[model samples]
Target: MSRVLLLGGTGDALRIARSLRAEHVYSLAGLGRTPVDLACGVRVGGFGGAQGLVRYLADEAIALLVDATHPYAARISANARAASSDARVPYWALRRPAWEPQADDDWRFVDAWPHVVAALAPFRRPLFTLGREPLAHLDAIPAHQHWTVRCLDAHPGNERARIIDARGPFTLDGERALFDAGGYDVVVSKNSGGAATEAKLQVARERRLPVVMLRRPALPAADREFGDVAGVIDALRAQPFPIVR
Candidate 1:
């Protein structure tokens, strides 16, 4: 049987991995502070860039490659595209749709993080839910304005900032409570477009708080693209089991 290499981290990845357990082997970048419960034969960490991934494909005999990483993870997605071409493996992407604002939503779509920082200057208490990696851009927020940075882990390095470490699937009531306690005037978040972290947006709508939403980067053209796991599974199953290589 031909082996499949799955680049997994997002919810879509988990669903596809579970569905195609017999043919797919999952790999995670392991950047998260917490461990994710995935199926057996899962590998963690980088593959040393494109060349490294090429070597792994040949060594493990990966015939089909699935890129199902986070939307903001452009580097790995690019590497997967390059490495698949180099290794002559077929590839596909599981890209979820981004969330659209309702009539009551007060959203500002920004192209980049710097713009998010610039737009935040007017707000005194700005709430950042853009995740830890993107927090590096928080320096652009002027000294006058106070920031409430929320993430999943407490970094010893980030002791000086007002950091709130929490996880979610947050409820609207919970998000409201958080906003109320912080007295936030605005929210800065990536347009990650999923139900998992969308409660913040709902709360922002209710309070009529302005949201600086960072748009997703454009991905490279994939041989096949799917918005859901079922579509990905259907496409994968349609391909021939054996690769010529």
Candidate 2:
């Protein structure tokens, strides 16, 4: 039987990992929590780069490489595509669709950090949901601005910023309360399309606050692409190898 290798970090990836058998492997970048309850074997940390990944695929006999990482994780996706090609293995990706602006949403799309900073100049209080990226800029916060940054891990923020460590699948009411308390004039977020953290967008729309959205990067094409976990699971089940959970 052919063995599968799943690269994952996002919630969608975890869902896919849960459906895998013990013969399959679930790989993580070691940034967040590692699950001990998974039936499939778990491997943490990186494979150096594309060349290293090619070696790993060959050494481990990975027949299928599934990239279920976050949508913004462009480098890893690119490496997976390259490594799969080099190793002559099938590559699959779960490319989550980005969130679209609704009728009442005031969204400003930015391609880089400098652009995001420029767009945020006028706002006194801004809520940031771009993960750990905002933590590095805490010292650079403008004199008149106070930032509320949310990410996966807790950190000690400077006087101009406050860090809240939390995960999502957040509720609408919870987001409404947070927005009300923060009194945020603007929201800084990545266009990571999923139900997990999408409540913030709806709250922003309801409160008439503008959102500065980080643009999605161009990822390398995979042999097959899926938009959701169910589709990926179905595809895996259809593979020649037995993938029963």
Best by TM-score: 2
Q: Give candidate 1 misplaced runs (Cα > 4 Å).
A: 33-37, 137-141, 156-160, 237-245
Tens-digit lDDT track for model 1 on 151-179? 87775323335887887778888998998
Candidate 2 residue runs with Cα over 4 Å from true position: none
Winning candidate number (lDDT):
2
Candidate 2 — worst ten consecutive residues by lDDT sum? 236-245
lDDT, residue 70, candidate 2: 90
Measured with C-alpha atoms, the lDDT of residue 88 in candidate 2 is: 97
For candidate 2, lDDT tens digit of each residue in 1-245?
68999999999999999999998999999999999999999999999999999999999888999999998999999999999999999999999999999888999999999999999999999999999998888889999999999999989998889899999989999999998888999999999999999999999998889999999999999989999999999999998878748
Would you estimate the TM-scores of all the predictions?
0.88, 0.99
